[model samples]
Target: MDQSFLLMLSNLLHLHNHLDPTSALLSDAHSPTSTSSSSTSSSLLTSSSDAQWRSSYGLSYPVFTTVVDKLKPYIAQSNLSLPSDYAVAMVLSRLTHGLSSKTLASRYSLEPYLISKITNMVTRLLATKLYPEFIKIPVSRRRLHETTQAFEELTSLPNMCGAIDSSPVKLHRLPSDYNPSTYRSRYGYPAVQLQVVADHKKIFWDVCVKGPGGIDDAAHLRDSLLYNRLTSGDVVWDKVINVRGHHVRPFIVGDWCYPLLSFLLTPFTWDRTGSPAQNEFDAALMKGRTVVEEAIGLLKGRWKILQDLNVGLNHAPQTIVACCVLHNLCQIAREPEPELWKEPEESGPPPRVVESEKSLYYIGDNLRHALADDLYQRLSR
Candidate 1:
């Protein structure tokens, strides 16, 4: 047998002998029934009994010692005025356990005020340090090409760009109209929504939060910084269309909700009986768009905090934003494969059906034919 196991057995035996398991004396001393004399006796028994318990199950002093040593830097920089690692551990434990601050204090032997500070400090650090690594614009063409290739390999979709969508994190309904509309439920609950643009690699390039719940995807796009990127003249592509003759090529892709701008790719809609060509085109388009769906699944899977977060009014929206950033961090740290995209019980609508007969608005036959020709030419070569 292990030496440690034998030591634990001995300690258990000592506690069993010193502490009376069946007697009510331990409980009575802390109760109101105890007089001053009995209280003193109870306190002595409790102290000695606790010491024995520690000797049996408690972590070794060197364990805490090593953790504290490694935590000194995080502690020194923290504004909490307490040690950093202690604060971080306290916050993590609370988040993991979902315990009230008072409960955490009693369990962890920490001050309640210090617990709050630790949570806030660690959250802010995670947002600042970890977020940018996985959620930023790809500035270089080489990186963009790498991303494009990855998407093509994963989904067999050509000229692979990115996946885009808006996900609403539900919030508690408030009384005021302003607060009420901020929580929309096209799904099931009121929420503060964040627009996410993630690429094939499951990295979020741009994340915009704080759009109103009552607003549609188009309205959100109108007010987003992402819209500015679309309209920006700096991002140039040579082979794509020229709606306004801008330098920017139409390399980026969005779904139907996006505007028919010069540099974006959307699906082709077929009228009347769905042509084989159109079905193939639509399948290809959905193939690329599905990356975002899979990415979102992986994101929610890893950071379960996103699935059940209910932040206070002051930090509700920001917390959602922070969660998105952390989601990206986890994605970057551990890139899971296609299995991450497994179907949830409650998924969105069935695949779009613009049958051969329906007259859809953007189902421009001439334009689609032209676009299809161009794509075929490039892809064939």
Candidate 2:
């Protein structure tokens, strides 16, 4: 037997003599009342106060309890007897609080490796399993109509599906063999670009995490499955709006870094003296796109793990996706958001304009102009 295993065995025996033998081996099926799992939901898991629990896990007790109820079955494994709440708490502590595995082990009497292992498992599980259930872009006309109306109310643009943007999640540089330069962001650090499409509610319907930080926003979005679906006509924005005799499909608004598509709108350029209609169009479009910035801000604000990314490079991106899942969950649960989350200043320059087929680009530009004209007319009225 390994020395550590023998030591664990000896400790188990001695520990069980004083404590209940069965309690030491936490079972997945154990109820909250079970002695082994009793401490799983305790605020003292890492802190003494409920405030600590909320700040550390990014969810209140009621919310956390509901989440753990569902996680019980999914986290079950034959060899591992780790309680479900313990698994969730461990993962959330790392994610929401950004506590390191070593520190968690020291505080919780767990093996540091075990802490890391559980965090990764739960993160990947949330990203893979829970993502589809919670993160969905409404394809239904009713929901789309409602969302578009909401955006129009806010900014006077019709058939606006969502706002798209990319934010940098700071990370350590990968090995040169892994193309280190690509991960080096214009922010003067290694990062992964997290692309998100957020609705007015600050809920993300599409999240793409494949791009490295050095790439432009346009390249990042173009490579995403969301972009493919939109361009390839797989994700059909069926509700087309008529404005001043021009028919416009439901579209997403983005910054100048993104190219204008019939399904994606970008602001028009303005010289020192620009037209009133063009300026109003840009203003309304930006107001609509502000949701993405707020969404990313809330995401990073609520989950501090993305602030510096303490996890390994391979797992960092998945961790970010997991955070997105949790963010939507919290938003749905009506969890109280911390006001402390602040968006970092945009240190990178705007992405270069990507060349596309002129036919669609012109059509998109015309639609944009029409929408701007429509909004300008609305302001005039």
Candidate 3:
């Protein structure tokens, strides 16, 4: 293992001592019980009670087992000394509780190095092996219909398929080669950026982590593969509705920090400077945008590791992506929501239109105006 990785592990182990005493005590008390209960189960997989499993892993026992079953072949191929289920559970525990390798090693009676290896391997599998199955755009007719219908109910925005946002994942320590300034987020922390698009159910359909914390949200978004696909017309949503003669297609809602595009719509004016109809449209669009914000909160809240991401720089993206995958799994399973992780308030000027996208921008502008007028007229009656 790299010395920087070990150093980060050491720093995290030390920081773990400063967490809430009550939570630490509760975790310590129940962790052994969770272990013993799993040993008695037929597959030696999960805690006896759903509550116990959720407390330990932020998911129900059935979902935990489902994850294990899904990853079993991949984990088995790794030839891990521990059973595939046990390895998955162990890694989930670390991700859930933000436990350090030393702490986890002590709990499971394994060497710290082995614990680190298991964490990396399992997270890699979750991020890559399971990502395609869990996180994907709603392209199918049924899925798209369901998603758009749900959002229409929430925001009264026709053909709205998802909401988009980005959050900074703070790093516990910077890498040796990194310039501190380059890693510093607007929140004044060294971090990485995680951008996601989520449906009205708070389930993620798209996840991207391609830049350092210093990168602006709009810039990071433009650099994403999703942006390329959308710009190139490679990704298509067939559902379209005519509002005031504008053929409104399936689209996502975002805040002013992201550029306004034909498929990605932002508010008309962030400060209510627009006309009454425009203001109403902005309110409705914002209501839709809250889904992505809530999704990010649930992600960080359930996967506590994201609160203070301690992984090495190279592994940070995979760690964040794995948490997104797990978030989708939990959402699909209808797991109880945790306390929301409140982010710092966002404030910034709207993004400038991309030079090459001016035509699309004009189209989106006309579409927004038409929708606003149509929505205003409908509400007036």
Candidate 4:
């Protein structure tokens, strides 16, 4: 087994290693390889006096039930009698437990491919329904500024609309008939790329779902509608241009993984000499961008499906997209405190970056400052 997989197993089994302590449910309940086929499938107790052992640790049952209820319309429209509710529950359980399909098949007395298919089906339902509802743009500039101001206080950023980044979700390699480029990864692992823009609220604003594993965050943006909206109009600075055409594009926030564009904001580097005020402003901007990192971290933390490689299915691309949508749903349902986004007033300035990484400083500082100044002028105007 690879070190990463071993580490994951260790982390999962080593309950005390985590900050939030819990009893080893999986260990007590069943072995990872145990066949669920032989077990009695009676109605399990709905209520557990043990507050700690709620369905999937309390949220799973409600989340699955809500999802199933929403999916009923689709099931009715499609006239399919397939057990979508069970399928949804199975998928969530798979995600929560990080069990292999073979392991799951044995436990549920279902075929391995069927487990894969059901998981994919549920994800598609999620992509169609849940994704659009959870991810949305801020409708007004006032709302945008207020959102930015909130992040600014937290991360010392200004005129920032949101945080943006790309994360890799590993997938099992399909047969040779599938496009070979799709499964390639920088680390030589099979994976897929997802680009997301998260607002100051840490809510996903816009999402792009079809880059190959090897594509970096920058490459994904180049192909996204978000990037197209940023490069359309007359040059503001030598590098900045307006790209918003017929569609109204909100100001997007990303890290240094993107090129200089009018609508996006990033951070600053050390070597780039700027006015102290400008540096302060860039510092704030980078701080706000950190929320995307946090959002991605939270997403991966909840869905171990993203942590390891997924292979064997024919519909890998669709599954990858569906995972992102489901991730957003999980975020919304979990509804972490808004106070999580609030910048602490007492926090001091961020630590400086090392000199060796100064080569890319311009990318962060220039785009960040230009966008900040533009938004300030726009909002002030």
Candidate 5:
């Protein structure tokens, strides 16, 4: 176990001692009555209405139960005193409401240590056990067609499969041995960088947490598994369309912060000084990019823990990835969305081209010009 994690637990325990547990427990509107025990926790799991369940657990009762059922076997193996449903609910409550373990301990009438233990267990399961099932690339032909069609309708850009972007997940506290400078984000906070590829409906298909927040988006992306897979020709999207005599394969769009490649496209210029066709293509690409931005917003909005990620450094990546899995689940289940969490305006110089990728970059450049001309002609018609 990390010393910082142990220190964090000690601090929470000390904070718990100063807190009025009874009053704190009662203050939570979603908390069960004062006499409530594990039985009450179980009852609440089965009884809460959809709205109430969403308020307390960030998803409707049905979705909550779906999650509980899926993880029940693994969670039951933990040998917790509470029922599987209750334990999952308690952890979701913490994730949904951004409540500390001490606060959750008061609400659930359990030791703070128990709360932390359960949180780690459940989040780890979600990030690892359930991740591959929930978050996946649209490899199936039908799913791929649906995604590309939706993106085409949304942005009028042909063969756009997904939009990629990166955001900083802020860390509330840094480990003692870590230098703050390496983790300091452009937003002036210690954080880890999370890169994701969101489809038309803002469902994340790829997620990577590889570097500190201070790492620029381009560098972080270069370190990702998705980058390798795409560059190495391992992830081949079968759908291809010819635009102005150029064979345009399914590609993802990003802002200027990312490099342009045959499989990944970025804006030609941020200043809009190019030809009318180039400007139109840039606008359309940005429209497609909005889906990923909204996806990140919805992620943080629903899982409040992401807004000020309080988990330890070692566990931060898993926690963020867990929230992403939950986000995809909720999106798939068609749960009601909360207000979006807006990020500050982003500004950065264009990324430098990679020497090894120059050949691929030339191909991408030709494709962009051809696609722009094609799109401009069609729109004119």
Candidate 6:
């Protein structure tokens, strides 16, 4: 009944007010709520053709089949033999094409409650079961070396491991009782931030889904396990890679929104104010950091539901993380990028304030200057 939910419903129907697109779907979806607890469980098929397969769920027949096969073990039950496949298809109905639960219930001839249940079940599976195997940061020395080589090739900077960035996924404004202020975003709605780390290939290696879309990137990253391990020196990097006599640490490149550290390198400045050498380093760093941006682009592009999370706030983090897991899966499956995918305008970063860690801050500044001068000298030749 709230304005935000109404907005979501209006957007979902997208029908002229005169047209009652919901009458049939809603009546059918809510039928099970009646005294009769029985409803026919028929297959979902509109007169729409194979094109609907891709358009409705962002999966071709073959890919859908493969997903079914992969998820069968976790979702199979005697009450629902191919439950996993149906569950996956149900979740994708919203993720790929942004169909509401009522609309999907009508399409599948199932109840709205059942549709919600299936979607939640499948999302948890992807987030918990599949995430471990697919969404891992390359820790092995050989794997780290490969990722470093890839980043170095892209930016002409050595020992680069990954690009980091955060994107806000829009969500329905929470109920009045739910403290909506926590979810407020720059986009004039509630949202949750999806922080990601990606390689040159635009595959996400790490995802942190802890932000309420209001927190700054620096705070979010600091709270992440990635930061804890990196600072604690728990993650092992290969022997110091000497780049033209400069000791390069295995580091990830971020934008000016993040703080620079021995292991996490951000640009010296956003504007071109520094010396040519420092400017050159910033240019290369920004160029390489685009990988995470592009990765997020591809992610939200493929899963349109993330464009507006439409799901409950309790499920927002799980849903975003699940989408990342599925993104990696699709990339692994060699699925082609979705055509006509448009990247959403990301929220601007807040002005950074150095709270503490002055000693390390100075060290980071020295490292940036050194790298910039080194790169500038090379470019001069």
Of 5 and 6, the candidate ahead on TM-score is 5
Model 3, span 133-187: residue lDDT tens: 9999999999999999999898887999999999999998898788988889989
lDDT of 2: 0.75
Model 2 lowest lDDT segment of ten: 15-24
Off by over 4 Å in 2: 1-52, 106-109, 172-177, 270-273, 344-356
Which candidate order results from sorting by lDDT in descending order? 5, 3, 2, 6, 4, 1
- TM per prediction: 0.62, 0.85, 0.88, 0.66, 0.88, 0.81
Model 2: how far is 357 from its true place, Å? 3.7
lDDT string for model 1 (20-82, tens) is 343222343224343333243344333334323223212122332333444455656655443
| lDDT, candidate 1, at 125 | 55
lDDT of 5 by residue, 130-199 (tens): 9999999888899999999999998888899999999999998999899999999999999999999999
Give the whole-model CA lDDT for all candidates, comma-separated. 0.50, 0.75, 0.83, 0.54, 0.83, 0.70
Scored against the true structure, residue 270 in model 3 reaches a CA lDDT of: 91
- Against the true structure, candidate 4 reaches a TM-score of 0.66
Task: Give one digit per residue, the lDDT tens place, for model 2 in 7-99.
Answer: 433332332222222233433222334334446344223333345457557877666776677666678752445657766866786787677
Q: List the residue pairs that clash in candidate 5.
A: none
Clash counts per candidate, in order, are 8, 0, 0, 13, 0, 0
Q: How far off is residue 26 in model 1, in Å?
A: 28
Of the two candidates 2 and 6, the one with more favorable TM-score, higher being better, is 2
Q: After superposition, how far is residue 67 of candidate 4 from its true place, in Å?
A: 1.5
Cα error, residue 25 of model 1, in Å, equals 30
